[model samples]
Target: MSKEVSEEAEHAPPKDYTDPPPAPLLDVGELRLWSFYRALIAEFVATLLFLYVTIATVIGYKVQSQNDPCGGVGYLGIAWSFGGMIFILVYCTAGISGGHINPAVTFGLFLARKVSLLRALTYMVAQCLGAICGVGIVKGIMKHPYNSLGGGVNEVASGYSKGTALGAEIIGTFILVYTVFSATDPKRKARDSHVPVLAPLPIGFAVFMVHLATIPITGTGINPARSLGPAVIYNNRKAWDDQWIFWVGPFLGALAAAAYHQYILRAAAIKALGSFRSNTRN
Candidate 1:
């Protein structure tokens, strides 16, 4: 009886899911496909629209709030602008390019082997260019206010130490990237699909909540493209001084989130080790 029970346990079907084989590190053949270029276009346009709407809202709010303490859209509104734009863009472009408007998200997926290095780098470049163009359009439209107001630049706000700002960015970006991993997890998709439209909702809300928490610290730059665009267009020395934090913090956060989800939550390392041992014995 004991032998039979042990054999039954050993032969039990697998209970957990693992992602399929990882994407190639580089797939040069992707360049030959029209769909690949189409995806790039989708990412570019999504990011452009995201920056345009969000930055314009920020500049507008600053202008309004100065005149009347309650006149402008408050920080809450700014958060909504960022979060809502993300939700909208993600929903629109999910099928086309996975709607990665932020480089940090792309980086996280790359670390998890969800995207190739080539695609990741190209997406980041597209996002940055789109961001720059978006902000440029806003500046052209509202030159005086764009120059006078903050230009939606992210910096260490008054009374916040550099360390505090950096920490906020890192943690904030971790929340975002972690949410991305969770939302896109294959296991979850196999279970219920998250309704497609609803899949991006939580990711957007994550952005909203992080912005609310970190707005005062560093204007909440979980997305480097968002921060870099305004800084470049505005050309503010203060913004430039703190640029390192935005890039470093988000990338570090992406790394941490990917490691956490893939190694711990998914037990990828354990699975690989088990496979290696079984193969050696075989």
Candidate 2:
């Protein structure tokens, strides 16, 4: 009987409802290694490239649209530029750094127990620095045009209230961070997670769709670093005035998403299922 029980246990399927091991709040072990540095470098370069391409596209489009609204790529094209760049950059750097080019995404993942505090903080710093450098490069090359076109700084559009603008940013970031959590959930089947083409598309699409919805309201600042880069470089009072919305809205949205996905959607379902199983057994 003992041998039979042992064999049966060995053949049993893995538990269906097990939560992943929670990452420590501060993972000191990760900080002592060269791999950590490599990951940070990847994040820095990816964010830099992302900001450079997107900011230049914004400036270029504005310059081309000079007098005619129909002259340049317009709103839809600008949205695509931001989305497409994120897809490319995420794909390129996902393996090296988890491809968190946005600090909002990092914060969401940190709250969801996907990464440690140290990693989240370091990634945010790298991303912000990268963004600054990226926008600086654009300004350096196209100094006059860049500044003339507002340096691609995000601003609340005319006729919109600050409350409405903040709400737009909050919802936009919620969509983005929610998609990131769903895409990168480790509990996803191995085949799905390992599919080289799967994860980045949804995240990129989220950015694209959110931009389409919120661009006119708050110029679509779902990433605080993206907003800060242009604002810092432009150094305008208007940009500075509404800067808190970009940071506060995205962070709030990210936190809400983490709570919703991790606790309400994931953990609650597991608990309900476990209770159902217990009642059935009883």
Best by lDDT: 1
Q: At residue 279, give the lDDT of candidate 1.
A: 60
Question: After superposition, which runs of candidate 1 have C-alpha atoms over 4 Å from their true positions?
Answer: 1-12, 15-18, 192-197
Off by over 4 Å in 2: 1-19, 190-197, 268-282
lDDT of 1 by residue, 157-253 (tens): 9998999888999999999999999888878777675465477899999999999999989999999999999999999999999999999999999
| lDDT for each residue of candidate 2 in 1-282, tens digit (9 for 90 to 100) | 434444444565775444677789999999789989999999999989989999999999988899887888988998999999999988898888899899999999898777899999999999999999999999999999998888888889999999999999888999999998888776664536456757889889999999999989988999999999999898999999999999999999999998889877667445545556556656
Clashing pairs in 1: none
- Colliding residue pairs in candidate 2: none
